[model samples]
Target: MTSSSKTLGEFFDSFECEAFRLETLDDYSKSGNVDAYHAFLAGQPQPSDYNAGWVEELRSHTRAGKRVHRVHILSRPLTDYLSFELGWGYRKNSTGGEEFFILDITDKPNPLAGVPDFWCFDSASVVVMNYDETGKYVGSALLEPERVVEFTGYRDTALAEAEPFVEWWAKYGT
Candidate 1:
């Protein structure tokens, strides 16, 4: 395997036991309009019921001094997803001290130019290709104007290269 791939594999191996909560727009609908769906879910009788278990588990981890890492894969932009999930999780787990690490890969340039990348959301250590329209990726920062971090690459690579960022989050994210 390539060195980058190996590093990622090792990282995963170390955190294999870490529980991850995966929620996708597709889980609710194939139409892929997560914003609208989010609104719909909000109007539900128990809006926080869908991922209540996950929220509680995350809170538990936080209470025990474990940081909660969240990777959101989107077919559009990170801003909307982050806002929705973070807002919901925050509302549900108000007392929990949890840090969310989000890796949004919506409009990443292909490692090789001229080859069109697929437009879909997938996740492993981080969420990748969360938002792609016409096979073009856009970063979460672009989607959410408030987020200052720029999109560099896929989540896995970004994490591997961004040690300072990781460290900062680890140290102060909570």
Candidate 2:
């Protein structure tokens, strides 16, 4: 199928084996849950319903034996947005069976430097997510078939070098 023929949401709903994401940004505060971000910044406790829908969506996939996970590429001295995302968002999401990892490049060089944020579904299809400088949601593109080979390679490298989120969080989480 052509790039214009598929949407990321379609991929999310259909992937069978695994859905892997590589997050290359330190901040996505302006992208989704603006109100929750604001509340997090204001020092309010996370609402009970925070990310409930997405968590349910994740549970639906993981309970059926598929995998959903991501590796976030970041460095030392976490940004406020990163603090909110990791401390609140990731921890909350993981409860629903989504796995996470942290690939901190504070000391070592990032092996996948400059790679855009992408989601690889079943290691077969890739959808590149776009964001503006301020981290506002822009759009996404379903990459052509040939590009999945390179993205799948990137995915493997990320998983190989990254540490599980629980372990990383025990050491570095805010």
Question: TM-score per candidate, in order?
Answer: 0.34, 0.97
Candidate 1, 87-166: lDDT as tens digits: 45433553444433333334564232331212111222332223354322343211222221222233344334222324
Model 2 misplaced stretches (Cα beyond 4 Å): none
C-alpha lDDT score of every prediction, in listed order = 0.37, 0.92
lDDT of 2 by residue, 19-98 (tens): 99999998998899889999999999999999999999999999999999999999989999999999999999999999
Residue 59 of model 1, lDDT score? 68
Clashing pairs in 1: 74-130, 74-131, 75-130, 75-131, 76-130, 76-131, 106-137, 107-137, 107-138
Clashes of each: 9, 0
Worst 10 residues of 2 by lDDT: 1-10
Q: How accurate is candidate 1 locally (lDDT)?
A: 0.37
* The best candidate in terms of TM-score: 2
Name the Cα RMSD for model 2. Answer: 1.3
